[model samples]
Target: MARRGKKKGRPVSGWLVFDKPVGMGSTEAVSKIKWLFQAEKAGHAGTLDPLASGMLPIALGEATKTVPYVQDGAKVYRFTVAWGEERSTDDLEGPVTKTSDKRPGEAEIRALLPNYTGVIMQTPPQFSAIKIAGERAYDLAREGETVDIPAREVEIGRLELIETTPEGNSIFEIECGKGTYVRSLARDLGRDLGCYGHIATLRRTEVFPFTADDLVPLDALEAAAPKREEAAPEGGRPFAAQGERFVALDAFLLDTGEALDCLPQVAITDDAAAKLRLGNPIILRGRDAPVQADEACATARGKLVAIGEIEAGMFKPKRVFAG
Candidate 1:
């Protein structure tokens, strides 16, 4: 008897701006979407904690290749800092380890905002995903082992106090570059104000090119999946059809090129696209001005072909995408 072929899922491609609800891990969210779409591959651009919510960019198939671009993009978050209590995880999920009676006034909080703005050093929470010595910090923390996370410099483009509750909780919105941890900021702000704090509620409003408006709630996506019986065609097996019309999964997929919107783009000829796809460098035409940035996205006939570098009139393909 001949060996059987391996089972495969749909070759779905593009980005899904998942509005990750609280209590759902980033990996869990990705798995749910993957199962719903039956996509061949899926991954998230950034990891959002279970205690945190919003704007988790899910990339499928070719979109996974553009994750780095989206990950490197700036992010905006709105979070609440509950003054007077500090937790082991720096968020509500952790046990309270310290508490303070002091709560800063609205004026006091405003005065201290400047200190956190711009480049600053921050130590990540012990119960975090950051690895130390090939082990996750959270694992060590959970095991009651001392996990010393080092402080690193992160850029905060903007930080503003959005609101203050009568009960001592302060809401804030921050715009920062990649690697900036909101948990650390909340912890540091409390320390700075002489009032210990932990994040009560957290939500990411934007990630670079994507905003809150782009997010699709998990419930919405699940409801959109075609019913098994409805998806079956005459004389065909159930849920075995390919393409968007058959399943409607592609309706949620944003064009893969949209992920690279932050970078400058150049249009190339069909010949150049073919050369780039073959891992070859081609001379850019004079009409297409050289990109000042080191890396640029090259497209032909409105389809992304390669992400490459411009050096001395030569475009060298760093990564080529299947058209």
Candidate 2:
């Protein structure tokens, strides 16, 4: 995608999608952007292993506040699996944990994918960042301790086995909801088909509103002008272009169009914005119910600059994105 250049001397505070290259950890990607932008804060929506790469969402400035909203969006990945061998980590990064009797062909994989679709529970591999009792699960697993990481609900909206190489390599694409581990999915697919498998390669093609095409290359990000790294810390801080841009403070959620489509927008007067800025929750009128922005920025005259969604009959925020 073309670079969406900002006005000269503008502090940027918006979403930046990166077409991550192989060998960079997700946190490493965040650090690169934080250093490049030199903003005060930054965060990535999700994690991608160093061995696997693709669309990684980097949140800049106040946009970091909306990271969780995009995290819930379904992700699509393109991965290749090696047949006949199973790894302890479910991917090539781990040691050869087991071997199977036979290999499955392209046709067999395509036929087996349908069974993994729709709602399913996934038991994440112990070699994951998921915390069990506040310690990283992967670290514990490496120490040979058995920790039962509970199975969580996830959905594979679409699964298509695209091709199989003559050398026992199978490629597939999957669109799944949040909390999905492509590695685990690879392991499970192997078990379901009775031909053990290990992920040889993986790449995230899309994450909800963002996609690989929407991203800037790591090299490009590392080369942006007016380099903002000097005064900023690790994640950096929000940098808006020019004066503050008006992004409805809910643009991130609206980008998904789920909560936005389901919830009605309610405009408020300046008075409401002022009270909201001061931290007093107020319900605004909407057709379905009263909606409030979980967070609001105060302007002049208690005007409603930004607002978040509130619970029914109570002033509690559902979500409020940054402006």
Candidate 3:
């Protein structure tokens, strides 16, 4: 779909997934891409901390509206935990406040991981984006206040100890539902093995079809501005032509598990174009009135443009797809 304009604030719509590198937070990565593309509308589906790297999905233009659905997809990660060291942040970025003389066995460690699978409650580390009262939990902790973060339910479908070392550290690959904290799992694994532990390394391997293989190196984005522009045909997106990537908006919406297909596609009737241009919500008619209302949906797809629902019945122009 073609973007609605050459004016300011309109963004080219599509999905841009990157192999984020360690030490760059998800927001920073998204910001870099936004600046490179010169896009005003962009945001990431999930947050990967500065200490970790891997598949980071940045939604641009209309795709940004689909963040909740995309970010909620199951995630997989490969990580390493250092034994004998406990950090306040549950990662290397934290201060090492504890140590252990005892080493943990691999046999004992495997037994504890299963207990974490399925449903469990977790307290956010003092260093997290969760809010406590009016302030972010991490901010409160940074101020030296004791952070009594609340425990909330999260699901861990699979967390296997991929490997281990005599150094007391362990490597793991995890598949978990949204909101699961791998850092906490690493820390708890350390505890279960009778030693303190912290996450020494982490890399997200997958978020749906996007994987580590598709990720661009963090160093690539950090290079001094290149004189040549990397033009993305669909959005007129200009960024360094490294491993940067994109997925069409139509495919993005249809692929979402949401049952958008159930709704009938209504033609932009001559009477409707003005309203559509004004960005008003309108119900589409199907042979079955009840079904139309029940599946209330809207989409406008053409040469380089695809706009979908802003809400139930409301349609907004999303992106202008390049041919």
Candidate 4:
């Protein structure tokens, strides 16, 4: 009997801005993309609920290292709030917990927008991913346990009412910093307006440097990959022969450097890049002499070398990237 070895996928790297469709969990979307690309490693910057869709930035191979940077960036979302009913999850997925018929008028909704903008205290939905006592709050909530999510300060850059419907539904667009939950916003707004509400529809339009325009639908990505015929005798998977034509997964990848676009760039010499790669700091020179931001991307010949901090006239490598 022949011993079969584990199959190792290709060492693909870079970011894939996926337009995650509704009804699919973020984890499921990442797995599907990973398999389609046959990537060695994959991860997503943030989790978009199964009920919500759009702009999920997936990181493959080395790009996984930059997930934190993208996750911390600002996000924009457009959602609809359905008045007259409140759900346990704050979104349509959960059971209805309360009901009311008092829908806020357009004038009242506009006035309330200012109260939510800027920095304000927000209590995350009970059925949320937040950790409580080392377990997910949602898990506790589902088990019929009482969950009290405390209020925390979150920054909302902008919150505007887009439209209102006579059927007790309203659409809104919000630009907010990391950690802000749209479900919580909907839940609170209803309380303030004397009407119960829950998120009827939700879609993330932007996540930092990536926008809806950058997203590649799942179907398109699947079509781009070459179809595999069958498992080869040599333990390799063979792609269907297409007469002198083949598409490499790398063609679909955006440079990993794009993930750090929000950071200021500092060009460095080959020697400096080599030093940074070795987890060491390099003193800046010329126009790059004075660091403009506390943190900056150190690049060599236009390729990212490391993300580091500027202190004492030196760029100290905090996170080194594989070039």
How do all models score by TM-score? 0.92, 0.75, 0.72, 0.90
Give the TM-score comparing model 3 with the true structure, all chains together: 0.72
Candidate 1 Cα misplacement greater than 4 A, ranges: 1-7, 229-241, 244-247, 291-293
Write candidate 1's Cα lDDT for 197-305 as tens digits: 9999999989989988789998888788877555434475423454544345668778899899877888999989999999999888776679455999899999889
In candidate 4, list every pair of residues with a backbone clash: none
> So what's the TM-score on candidate 1?
0.92
Task: For residue 76, give model 4's deviation from the true position in Å.
Answer: 0.4
Model 4 segments beyond 4 Å from truth? Answer: 1-7, 230-248, 291-293
lDDT of 3 by residue, 1-323 (tens): 88786444334556667678777878888987776555557888889999998888887665665576567778999999998888999999989988998777788887787788888998777888888888998888899888888899998888898887666578999988888888888787777777889999998988754565545554555453333344333465333222234222122222221212333444545444555555555454555323223223333442222344434444454422221
When 1 and 2 are scored with TM-score, the better candidate is: 1
TM-score of 4: 0.90
Which residue pairs overlap in candidate 1's backbone? none
Error of 4 at 189 (Å): 0.6
Q: Residue 266 in model 4: shift from native, Å?
A: 1.1
Candidate 2 residue lDDT tens string, 22-109: 9998888887766555545678888999999888887765566567767888899999988778888999888887788888767777
Please give the lDDT score at residue 258 for candidate 4.
Answer: 90
State residue 198's C-alpha deviation in candidate 3, in Å.
0.5
| Candidate number of the best TM-score | 1
What lDDT score goes with residue 77 in model 1?
96
Ordering by TM-score:
1, 4, 2, 3
Better of 1 and 3 by lDDT: 1
The TM-score obtained by model 2 is 0.75
